[model samples]
Target chain A: MNDKKWIIAGIVVFLAIFAFPFWYNMGKAAPAPEVKLTEKAKAAKQCVMPTEYMRAEHMQLLDVWRHNVVRNAEREFVNTEGKTFNMSLSNTCMDCHANKADFCDKCHDYASVDPYCWDCHLDRSKENE
Target chain B: MNKHYLYALLAVIVLFFVAYVGAEVFGLRIIFGVLIPYLAVIVFIAGFIYKVMGWARSAVPFRIPTTCGQQKSLPWIQPNKIDCPNSTGAVVIRMILEVCCFRSLFRNTKMSLEEGDKLTYRWEIWLWVFALAFHYSFLVVILRHFRLFTEPVPFFIQLLEKVDGFFRIEVLYDTIQTGLPGVFLSGLVLLAAVTFLLLRRILLPQMRYISLAADYFPLFLIFGIAFTGILMRYFTKIDVTAAKSLAMGLVTFHPTAPKGIGGIFYAHLFFVSILLAYFPFSKLMHFAGVFLSPTRNLTTNTREKRHENPWNYPVPVHTYDEYEDEFREKMVEAGLPVDKPFEKPPETLSDEKADSSA
Candidate 1:
């Protein structure tokens, strides 16, 4: 009988390389988080957009708000409720959420996504954590 | 297929670059990034499989191995085993060497004219070196691209990144950093090699005679890709997180072309898309064809074993029995021994049963 160790190694290596992408993605997805608004956000009367619409597309709203306020220097945000509020993420949005880790960061971390809001905008609430 | 037409083809590619970049700059990012890339990838996979299957289904009936050494006829003569493989195992070894190391190309030689028509031959190692470098580096670069397409890049890929980026230069006594990597070295080397290969095809009389538009097309396309990649990595720096997100989107089939991704990225992407689409239909399919090449895959054991053509058809033939029957009287007169004592009754017999079995 011939010792085919090299051949066995080669076959094993080939299969491993071929199965790389599959194995790499194994258990990669973070478990879904139970995202609940802050007590302050819950006590607030209403949000800038419809609650259903905000749940589905809050990022688009934030992007539009960022562009309007930062790039165009237009700070006006007319909510679907017909109330105009200043387009300030820190002043307007975070005022309701209050705690990023509990409200914003919970969903973001659960999604394993970096919204990069913390990169530029200082989170004053982090000092309390 | 003319050499001059290759120049025109290269110009056409450059024109495409300008058009694609222009379109991206003018905000057709979705078309350039999402739609075209998906279509190109689909065409690439489908066409690649079609070509490979077409070749795989082809009939290679004869043993036509390109032999360059002594045959394995006599027991004493040692054959050049790998180059002129006469067995299945040897053929496998030869194919592995050919595919993995490009062994045949490594043995490339160049002939030069000497004084008074005398000729001198030189080893053409640079071509092999450049070709090998180009391929290995391209592999490395592609592997590194895993980071973009993958969420959390694999450990092996991260290690590769670390090893690839090992070469670093700190200028001004460690005050300033260049961030130049060994990975960039190969990328730049690949560009240089392609350029050199193209120049050889253009400048060398012998190479120019054999060169065609198809030869220059892939090289110039690769040049465009490498140039654009270099530009992105070193010059017009991209938001890599955004790029990775875009890549993940593409892989997941959602394909959201992220905003603020530079026009240069779209241009680079379009070139890669075109390359993939063109690969299966062009000479680039040699990557697949090399394994199926009859010359390299066949063994030189023709004399040792009888090889039959798979497509040989049945044909009626005259046998020795029929010849003997026709010449029976003549053979007896000439004192030749006759089977069955020279059939006097000239009767027709079935040639199929007499000697047809062999």
Candidate 2:
């Protein structure tokens, strides 16, 4: 009961404090203004294309990368010893993994995950395989 | 009393007096808007980085998951698996629910005892509503500001703007007409929600008693930012092209502080800078802290292998035989395990010594 009373009282006080400007503005006239959009901005807006359909070439490329690398290696292993030891997994993996575009673009173009990582890393799909 | 309420009241009074008296006494818009905003930005960036790094450096050595639901238990019991996640995979899902859905907050219940001695648990859903409004509105407001930075606004942003302004009602009365800007509506909604949040903390006795200056300061600063922004949008109009150009200049690394932006915009910018600078140092840093917490990250895979604390030091161990030797007689009398063959060793201590010498 006491808590409820206090909450009600606090809310009432808060409303009263903030309500002043609201009521004052109620009687006042509304203001109207117009803003102009720049021509350069309008031109830029026109060039943007709506992305909808998935490309078949992307899916085929992705299929090649996914099957050729990740599934080729049957076993995964870890080494605690600090040595320049080579693993079969890395041998199969690093060829495609060395560059993001070799793997990421092929799948992302098909998967519908919009290319944000490409903004930072180099796209190697364009490079000679 | 809520310190934020007092601070906000003081800010409104002081800012109003400054805007009215200062402008009347000595007219200056550049000092109010550009210089102060610039200073605030510097402070905010420096402060934000410092605070986040400070949190990152702090070491949390133990695992303490704040669990409310059933933990991983007997296989037949069908564990409330999502609540008490025992693996990294589960933790990710839990984190998603926590961050995106605010799962715990959604389940928040208020308790009350009725007149007939019956206990009641009612959903305190308003807190969730306000919290959602505050976060999403703030997000929309930030996204909307992207329009000023990028030359071409993204399609998603354009879609958001259209969706936001679905109800296009234009009320006209004698040369005065009012239209809605969706971003402005969201900003106002955020302000209302934040105000409510601050009020809840102040009004509740338990919350008020525990509340510190750190808790109050951000709320006060945010309120100031909201109020100043509201003033800029509704009361005083600013030059949008100049503002956009200034933002673009900042992004392009050749910041030329445009002249003609309103003082209220500066006040808003100043408050935002203060918030940014204060973010890393304040309790509001839970935003970054959430990512680093080991309780949320570590898997409960103790059954598989021992997790040796990298910081633990090695210690020597003593055998139980040494302990038994000290109390051998007591052990024999008590029929406990003894080191020596007690039944066969009948000779007294002196006789045994003499026989060995012979």
Candidate 3:
């Protein structure tokens, strides 16, 4: 088994080495179809500050303080969904995802794919119940 | 075997299976390739934020900075200001030097015995070279990749590219190839360094013993990410723009895993995903953990002012005088000198004779 592992590893290393030149040469001989640069790449060039108007329009220190202080700091309880239950991020995630019908169970009930984090994070979920 | 070694072995096996066997064995290419990368990024950001917040909230009342150099003292004595920075400005410079250049690590040495049984501190320059290579290459690759992740490639990104690929190796294909500031070369060097680091840990029994699976797994996983990335760049090319769009979407929270991206891309994605999900739970958490460490963040003002650990409990301490009194008879019998003379010949035991004679 170990020998087999070594053999496979060696092959991978060999292939990795040769793969580059092979692809480059192939591209040279027969050009592959061009892949468009992603919008993000385009954005990299374009996503500059829209305007400096906001920064330029300065408010008096007292006015700014009054505006900030008058309004109560809004507590963000739930996300876009108007779920009223208050909980921290990790706990909120756990609360829904821990049970069969609640979260883990719902996902598992649907045979949806779970991830490696579930192995550790779910341990707490199980213990919570 | 320790649990970590087991995890390392497991990681290797899983990597092998995914890279070679899994596709053939289970026909689950997308799972191994695409989903993993998607998952990894999500988890990485979430986990990083979670860990950082956790550190930020953790109570640290006392300031304790570990100093290795001389402190500020009398005018005649010079302080090793760089080593033990006294001011915040000095600390910031020190931190910049540390984080950017790994200045302290650059001075690393390996001690070994020579033929004459003499201890020699040989400079392990390669370790520093590789470390610097890995980090700097990582930085470059990330900067190069900015083109794919943002809407318009930032001017800085273009500038960085110009600086990086200043030497263009134009091929006959007429596509101006950027070579001088090439990320690919740096990435390869980084991979080589990471590989060397892993081997150093594994090959040396001392390191191997101390290492947990957490150590091995990240190395294996990162190695896989690099390997698969190399594959995508050189072995087979993917749609660079499409990949970037997907990345941008991810950043903007509009998740979309594009189709026709190929199985190898998915494989690369999967490896990255594994790294992300595993990061917080593994030694890689050091990225955030370093910021929270009292030894690094704290200012060394305790010497000037009393700063006690909140968790400390008051314990009765026995003084040296008490110790001497307790063991006086035994100490005298052993010919040890005593402060209180046993002779008793002089009545007022004292003041006049002691002062006058002294």
Candidate 4:
């Protein structure tokens, strides 16, 4: 084969880059993060939306809440089951799921999603600490 | 409409539905997620090596690099280093520009015959622009996907994410703002570029005439993957946590298919797998073959170095000396010069005539 050394080197580089995830992980299983719900969250038995909907779309829902409260000046949210609640992430959602590290940060870190909610919204749980 | 593109489109659609139905209806997440992906990776690596090795084994016996400018010769005359490279360094620079910038394609021209035997050539730049866009965006999207596979996602991936989503375009429907995250521009650009490329192939008469099924298959397949990915991210939001878990598990060799990763995600994976498996067998192998292309990679240094034909070998030949030695008697009889006198002199034609008269 012509330029055999260079060809092999090129393939080696390609394999190293392409199989990066495999070597980077090194067979260490990254177990899916478990969101530890607080006592209040457990006792409430339900959230503003279904658990599945919240799991998939809590970010968008929070964004909508932010827009409504800050931009539209609407502080009230009427759920599908005809229950009305305050549209605040720090006050309302944090009332039940108060532990940001255990509840929010677990899945966010696992999924590598850096939501900017914490940039403005203070974690009261951390404030007490 | 070319039947080739239609067939290619049908194939991609069938593959998509097969994956969707397999995952959603039959609940065969293991097959779609684990088994098929593993198989596709294996096929991709093996097939890629095989194709590249085949190219490497072929002998290029001459310096046949396609040059558009002056080659190295006299000391006073300037040489086009990048265009007609004579040194290894110049060739490397040329290859870099060709690979990264699509420099050759940037020089693409469209030729047309005008009235009264007039021929005209115009620089066509759209293909180069869209091609560059498509390739770079695709690269960014692929790099961003590493976030799913790594446990502590690399710093570079996070930086890439930040750069890609710099615009932070929030999706809002009517007065009610949706909870969707910021849309990354790379995905959108990739989709748009692919659409343009596909449309060009379909809309242009010359391109459409030249394109085969192989040409359309990858485009349609990529379009499907991008479409499904966008759908998952924006519209039919899937449990990204579950998706990441599946991705991490696959990378760590602890394969698991967590529930709630929607059918569209499965469709996306299946399309990617098909592309990977098809890569080495199709024109997509250009990714590797570009390095091996004799016309592109070879340095134009025929004046400096000897390039011997690889197939050249010893050939048996009848030399002039051997021919003269064998026909020496005949040559001497016919009044031709001989290198050596014959031991037994041969009769001349005039002597034979005299003997016949006697």
DockQ of each: 0.04, 0.01, 0.01, 0.73
Candidate 3 on B1-358: residue-level lDDT in tens?
5577678868765765565455445556545544555676567667766666555556676676778688767668787676677776777667667767777678888888898899999877877777788778767866666555444444676677656655434222223322211334656766887898888887877788888776788777777777777766544555543455455545454546554455666566666666668776677876556545666555555565577666568889998788888888688779999887554336556766887899
Q: What is the lDDT of residue B84 in candidate 2?
A: 72
Per TM-score, what order, best first? Answer: 4, 1, 2, 3
- Candidate with the larger TM-score of 3 and 4: 4
Tell me the deviation in Å of residue B200 in model 4: 0.5
Put down candidate 1 lDDT per residue, B231-349, tens digits, no spaces: 76654555554566666666655567776567778888888888888888999988767877788888898999888877679989999889888888899989999775865452334
The per-prediction tally of clashing pairs is 0, 2, 25, 3
Q: Which runs of model 2 end up more than 4 angstroms from their true locations?
A: A1-129, B1-4, B7-60, B116-121, B174-177, B180-184, B302-305, B316-348, B351-358
Candidate 3 docking category? incorrect
Q: Whose TM-score is higher: candidate 1's or candidate 4's?
A: 4
TM-score of model number 3, chain B? 0.72
- The Cα RMSD across the true interface for model 4 is 1.6
Residues A1-129, model 1: lDDT tens digits: 111353345445744663454455555542234556777778875688876556544655676677677778999998867899999888898888778877877654333344557788878687657
Local accuracy of candidate 4 as per-residue lDDT tens digits, B32-72: 99999999999999999999888777777788999979999
Model 1 bad stretches (over 4 Å): A1-129, B1-19, B170-183, B318-358
Lowest lDDT 10-mer window, candidate 4 chain B? B171-180
lDDT of 1: 0.71
TM-score of 4: 0.93
Worst 10 residues of 2 chain B by lDDT: B174-183
